[model samples]
Target: MEAAISTLITEFKKYAGKDGSSSTLSKDEFQSLVSSQLSHFVKNASDPGTIDQLMGSLDENNDGELTFTEFWQLIGKVACQQGCFSQ
Candidate 1:
């Protein structure tokens, strides 16, 4: 569990760093992260419009980029949907 969480953070940093912003994910960076790393988890992961909608939904501050907190909302939602916390 610890390893999985670590990997999530690492992956977030990796993608977030792609466009010179190690602290947030731009739309293109988010798209790349989702399409490449989360395709199996996200529906329509490769579709640009889908990505656009997701980015908009998760961009809590309407800043056009996703901070780690915003991005974590997605991870938590996906995990819950997958029953990752179910006993």
Candidate 2:
């Protein structure tokens, strides 16, 4: 679990650093991250419109970028859907 958490942080940073911010993910960075890292977990992961919609949903402040916490929401949701935390 600790390793997984560390990997997640590492992965997030890897992509999040693609742009100038190094703190949030722009649409393109998010798309790249999802398509490459989360393809198996998210359907139509590389579709532009799908990524657009997902970005809209995750951009809590409508800033057109996703902070770490916002991105974590998707991870948590996917994990729950996959029954990773089932009792």
55-74 per-residue lDDT for model 1 (tens digits): 99999899999999999999
Please, what is the TM-score per model? 0.92, 0.93
RMSD of each: 2.3, 2.0
Q: Which candidate should be chosen as best, given lDDT against the real structure?
A: 1
Q: Find the 10 residues in a row with the least total lDDT in model 2.
A: 78-87
How accurate locally is residue 80 in candidate 2, as Cα lDDT from 0 to 100? 86
Whole-model lDDT values for every prediction = 0.93, 0.92
- Give lDDT tens digits, candidate 2, residues 10-40: 9999999998799899999999999999999
**Runs in model 2 lying further than 4 Å from the true structure:** 84-87
